[model samples]
Target chain A: MNLPPLVQTFVLHFGEMGSRWGINRTVGQIYALLYLSKEPLNAEDIVERIGVSRSNVSMGLKELQAWNLVRLQHKPGDRRDYFATPDDIWQIVRTLVEERKKREIDPTMTLLREVLMQEPASAEERHAQERMREMHDLFELLTGWYADVQRLDTERLVQLLTLGAKVQKILEMKDRLFLVPGSKKSRRDDAKDK
Target chain B: MNLPPLVQTFVLHFGEMGSRWGINRTVGQIYALLYLSKEPLNAEDIVERIGVSRSNVSMGLKELQAWNLVRLQHKPGDRRDYFATPDDIWQIVRTLVEERKKREIDPTMTLLREVLMQEPASAEERHAQERMREMHDLFELLTGWYADVQRLDTERLVQLLTLGAKVQKILEMKDRLFLVPGSKKSRRDDAKDK
Candidate 1:
């Protein structure tokens, strides 16, 4: 499948971004193609469209599958595997956040636990350890809040995301109800704004 | 120099996360070291500390420098090039956002423009092109907002971040500001809330 110069450019750019984001360049480009595509794409179609090796496309699909960013589809009478993106961008964003938390945040929390058991040899070491503890606690609270948010219906999320800039004001007013521990206040200087 | 176990744990976890965030594992680990370390480190110290090849450290440092996440500091009477991270996490976050916008968003915008210029061969193709236009426009708005947010002082930015979830709410109401094209009220189900 020959791609228009414009679509090809996006594919290429995502490929480069892929490496920066943790996915390989090929995976990034592949995703870009999928995102822009109006229809579900099969692996072979992706292979031809992007001009990469079949095996590479296969590998890329597998990785995308692992990330939960790709949806598998089946068409009647079709033996080949097919994939599509969730229709909602908000859903995509939410999934991205959840997957990142799993792959990135949760593991870091586990590492922090291991560090907490170590012996501190000096006053400074103890102070450093305390800082580490604070960071760990904060992250734990953050991870919990993320999980809570994820469980909310999609409508609630869009309600939250659209909040955009005013989110600070509500927090300042204590918004009364949304004030969970980690959710309570920011450690940054803006906390003074409230 | 011996690292306390907590810092060491963070280093290892960040190294793992590097692959996920689009950075190399070693590069992530090196940055983790720099972030946690109180002193600037030379390439040799990084290589020795991380047990990576000196050349790899050099390459990673070069990339970090390009991202503006790492800085060079020369010690008195020391000929070696040493590097360190910004003391503020928000600074690091802001820099990351800026770099990602430049490297990822800017190029994608270029591609979207190219796609818009292409002549659609069929009505179906036209429909797909229309969707692409919407996606492109949304990205353009998002990138512009990021640029605006970047210009805000650290204190203001913190205020925005500290507002956390509420910021998302305000962003939802942004369309009320004017008769902007895509900025028009979203038909999304959650559009009416806060």
Candidate 2:
């Protein structure tokens, strides 16, 4: 089956962007095709639409499944496996964030922790450990926040996103109303009260 | 100068992860070295420490500077250039986010917008366009939120991040106390009120 010109353009663009995001071009193209497809498509359909080998489509599908970006389905009468992206865009975004955190952030955090545990043998080693500590702390803060936000319902998450810069106003209000002047302990106590 | 084993372990690990983050191994290693170094390093020092060619170190430094990941400094009496990562980790994080957005996210967003402008030629094309629209909307929401948060002072940002799951409670409070019941429009209006 031939893809429409518009689909073709998007597929090509995504294919090019895939390398920059660590996936191969074929996997990106296959995901794009699956995402835009109105119905679940088999490997053969993907190969025909994407102009790749059957094996390549199979491999790409496998990788997408591993990333939790695509879902496998079976037709009522057909025995061949079919695939499609989640219908909800927010779910797709959530999957992408979670998978990336697992693959990219989690391992680095582990390495930083392990490196930080070792005794610094020199001033240079001490500085490197300090840098690693900073990185580890940043990653912990980010990933922990993401994990918390990930639990929110789509409606609530959208509310937060749409607020955008208004959140800064909210943060200022939080600081002014919650914290006692000149005491970190009061801030901690206020956070607990909330 | 030879790097300590502890620093070497981190440099090597970062080098491996670098390819996944869209940079080559040498560039990742060079950045890691500069980030962990106690003082500014010159090209010769980097080349010797990273065990890469002088030309490769020069090119990697060029790339790092382009990403705003490394700073170029000159010794008062010496002609040779020196490089170092920013002392503040938040600054580095901000640069990484902005640069990646510029390179990876912005172009895809522009392409999605342009593609959305074109009239769909068929039912399949229409479905593809819908998917693109969803993706574009998600990207807009995310990048806009990021830009807003980027403007925040580091202390405030840290407070927000450390709040983690507690943010959900805050959001719920905002919704109940601030927004009029049963209307998305009212919630948006309330945001504008502040």
Candidate 3:
């Protein structure tokens, strides 16, 4: 519970930004604490440091586990369950994005699809469908591209991101190469996907 | 206020997903209504349709305006203000990303930078600082790449995303091209050997 001042400052800042991050104060604080800790921590440690009720820590851990943001571990000869953020920082980022898409985007995409399935009975409804269609298409492309980028290994992902806008020039080059007659079909297909 | 079943379903669904999106329920519902509306809607129209108190709609509108997600308009011969989402859906997406980064990411980045500047007083704090450094570096990469991608016009963004993992192959090709005696890509990258 006696966190160094540096760690404590981060925990407090995270708690303040909790609502903005779509988590409660205790949840954000707990995650931040675990994120900065060198080792796993039990509920007692969280409650003591965060100064929240035991039940608040329990609930925060439950929500965090549900989001796959925290992992549970058992110490040798110790019965208390300990929690830690995933060790791979990039994995944490990937999990955050995937979990968020599952919660916020997938549901809206479903709703948009369901609504689009309905027949519009009025001009207003028809106009509404146009907007929904635009949303649906945008989400489809975005999610598809996200999945593609998400599947890469952390090194590859970092490379892709570091490449930045240079990727656009590469795509143009690929197109020009494809213009050549009798280009390798299998290579073309491979580059086109996966 | 008399929304067709299709539109109403989306409104309700979006409201349900509001907390997940880091917005209040009424704010989500209001945005959904405005997003699908053919014309700008006044507060009365929002209250009547959303079935919330006038004050609730007013607060929701105020929050939306603060987030820059909604635009305020004045009607000829009407004293009441009207609200509508940006007409360009891509622009709306950009605004949401920019606003969220400003509110949620920028502050955290500042905190991380400040905390990182402090000297660690103990071994535990040194380990914690390592974790913080990793996070700081990851965020620096992500935010930098995001800014690069964000600066591109929508057409270019779509092209870059649509290119998908093919971007990796292009990088490899560029590397090989630079491997020639007088290559252009700078031979120093050969050490990466990725």
Candidate 4:
């Protein structure tokens, strides 16, 4: 499948992005193809369209399926599986964010907790542990906040993204307004607190 | 040169994270050391400290220097270069954001622009171009907005992150308050049309 120049650029960029994001080049390229293609594409079509090996396409598809980034479709009278991205960009964004948080944030938080539990053998150890504590607390608040933010409607999410600098102003004032800004804030904060 | 168990965990996690964030594992491990260490360490020290090869430490330090993530410190009596990370997490965050935007976001925007200028040869080509344009615009705005946000003081950044759901709610309302609902509006939208 010969790609149009525009999509070809997207494919190449996403491939590079995949490495940056810890995914492989082939996975990124396959995702780019799926994201751009208007129709549900079968494995052979992806292999043909993207000019990758059939096995590579198969593996990439499996990874995409694992990430919940693709929806499977089967044609009438056809046993081959086809895949396409959801129409909603927000859904795609949410999945990417959630999946990443699960892989990166949650595990790091767990490791942090274990490190914090270790007894300090020296002043340096104590200082290091203190820093770990700060990071762990921050990440916990951050992950919880993001999960809650993810629960917002797409429009609401976009609103937050577009807030530009206003969001900064609000965050700085939050502590002043509520003194103790723990997870147990108020019902309003809890409403969106996921 | 042995590391505390907790620090060892940090190193391994950062090594994994480095790959995810487009940095090499060794480089990430070196960075984790720099971040957690109480003093500036030389390249040889880092090699011994992390139990990695000298060449690997050299390469990792080179990459870290390129990212502007690590600062090289000079010791009066020592001939070797020493490195350390800023104590401020916010500074590191800003540096990473800026570097990633430069590497990934900026180049992709340029590619999108070039593709947009090409005349469409078919309806499919036209559709692909349209999608590219949307992606390009969204990314440009996002990076621009992020740059603006990055300029905010730490107090402001924390304020924004803490805004959480409220920020999301505000972003969702961009359509009603702004002209041209559900359409691509440039920064020029703020200015009246002739």
* Highest lDDT model number: 2
Q: Candidate 2 residues B61-176, lDDT tens each?
A: 99998999999999999999999999999999999999999999999999999999999989989989999999999999999899899998887788777887687667666666
Candidate 3 ranges with C-alpha deviation above 4 Å: A175-194, B180-194
Better of 3 and 4 by lDDT: 3
Q: What TM-score goes with each of the models? A: 0.74, 0.93, 0.90, 0.84
lDDT of each: 0.72, 0.87, 0.86, 0.77
Q: Flag the better candidate by lDDT, 1 or 3.
A: 3
How would you encode candidate 4's per-residue C-alpha lDDT over A1-194 as one tens digit per residue? 47877678778888887877768989999988887777889999888878889999889989998999999999999999999988776678778878988887788888888888889888777877877787787786677678677778755455555656655444434434555655455444534422
Report iRMS (Å) of candidate 4.
4.2
Chain A, candidate 4, TM-score of: 0.83
> What is the C-alpha DockQ of each candidate?
0.28, 0.68, 0.55, 0.35
Per-residue lDDT, model 2, residue A156, is 73
Better of 3 and 4 by DockQ: 3
- Candidate 3 clashes between residue pairs 3 or more apart in a chain or in different chains: none
Tens-digit lDDT track of model 3 for B1-194: 56788889989888888887788899999999999999999999988898999999999999999999999999999999999999899999889999988988888889889888999999988988889899989988988888888888887787667766656556767777755754444455454556
Best by DockQ: 2
The CAPRI class of candidate 3 is medium
